[model samples]
Target: MERWPALELASTIRHDGDGGVTDDLATVQGTTRWIRAQSDLPAGHAPAGDIAADEELRTEIVALRRAVRALFARAVSPAPPSPADARRLMPADQALAHLNAVAAREPVAPQMDWPLDGAPVTRLLSAEDDPKVRFLAALARAAVEFLSGPQRTRLRACTAPRCVRYFVQSHGRQEWCKPSCGNRARAARHYRRQRTAADGGPAPGGPS
Candidate 1:
């Protein structure tokens, strides 16, 4: 199974300074759809049927998102806590509990198979139709692999101001998630220097 999509699921919400920018997977059905779109589903197997529109499922999805976010915090520096008035979306303990439960679910197993060249290979297989459980298990397992893999060092949180997303650094000089974010960061820096100059002071981060 592809691990990147499961890792991407952890980014459903983007943490900002005071608030967070949430993606579209805010509901049970939406989460299910996202999983289907991201996961390697079998041929002719439908994903929408497994998803249900219910409060319980919604709660699970929200909890899962929070758990993933909390896990991500372990790998990257997280934003500061929201103010008292703003709801603390994901408590550390709660997220941990949910993640543990998800991890407890059975993982997708590898099937022994051989190609036409008789080369040995193992194929990951999953027959579960329960999108919630399946995705939870898949994501939890993927998280373990990701955190332990060499690629973990490449995982980075986007440093662009107000951008709350994580990305795998593809190049040595890559910093932001995308070129647009890099551009924004550069623009923000230039603006800050100009503002400092206008204030009759040395530009921030510049020569004294």
Candidate 2:
């Protein structure tokens, strides 16, 4: 039998809905937890409190999850001075660091930057056997689509004066939360001054 935690996470990911914040949070947390449980899930081995007592398996699973997350984060949101960014930040998935490196070593290359990575991330570590690696890799691609495609323009940081979370807009017309961030942001300037004075100086990070 598999651990309940892992199964619970699977359930969370499989949920279907409009994927609101509650949905997104549950999905993200489930995905994160599941990535951490890779080794255990593959074999019949799960951690003890894991409900399976598979120490070695759990260790390996954690490693796999970490790898996938690394690739996913890299693919989805790699750091700057970055190879992926050097290439067109569109058509998203074709820029795996490993693939770019392999292409570079070939003698017959094009003149136009053949993927424009003046200095790319060279160390590539991944397992050919893990299915999760592919799964997450694909997910990273979809995430990029959500980020750079039209959906990206729809992403808005809470306009709420004090809220710092981001939310996806449906109808392409929404902004900030209807309850918290939205109302808070709508408060008049006088109210903002009063709130600022009462809180003793622009609420920590100060107005952005």
Candidate 3:
């Protein structure tokens, strides 16, 4: 068995860490609680505990949670990273933790109530060939991988001001966390929108 992946997964699960866990790995108590709360309808589920009303979303959430948990299991294992595995899953390890953090609920059933609590993620995380689940699992799997030199360079980040998010920064002049951030930066420099002859000088190229 390993350690970090489980811890990383636990960090992603905000619901659990605050209150601590009992038989944490055995049962997804915090994730389930979070799911129930998010998917519950104010007028119904919360009021009457109606699982049938929100079955789909709950199922999807559970499946995603399970898939992510399994990914964590695979990542932090003591086994060495194999060349074939690296080729297939060329991604930054930190991204795995990030993605797992965002694995909130997704609806799958029409309605839900006292839905049977079984294995978390099912077919996809298991041996099944479900395309969508397979896709998500693959992404999770990649996060724990090591890429080639070209990929590492392409996927690196910039130390530019307010730009810490990872991205394909291979292009020589790349900076800024996101285009929106850059746009706002440029806009902030502007004094005003447009200037008429009566107002003052031209729009001043709207600051760079």
Q: Return the TM-score for each candidate structure.
A: 0.73, 0.33, 0.26
lDDT of 3 at 102: 35
Candidate 2, 92-153: lDDT as tens digits: 24434433332233222112323475643332233333343333333333333343455444
Candidate number of the best TM-score: 1
- Model 3, runs deviating above 4 Å: 1-127, 130-133, 144-149, 154-165, 177-180, 189-208
What are the per-residue Cα lDDT tens digits for candidate 3 across 80-169? 222212233424444455455432111222233343676433221234334334333333333333232243434423233333223345
User: Which TM-score value belongs to model 2?
Assistant: 0.33
Best by lDDT: 1
Task: Rank candidates, TM-score, best first.
Answer: 1, 2, 3
Ranked candidates (lDDT, high to low): 1, 2, 3
- When 2 and 3 are scored with TM-score, the better candidate is 2
For residue 23, give model 3's deviation from the true position in Å: 29
Lowest-lDDT window of 10 residues in candidate 2?
Answer: 6-15
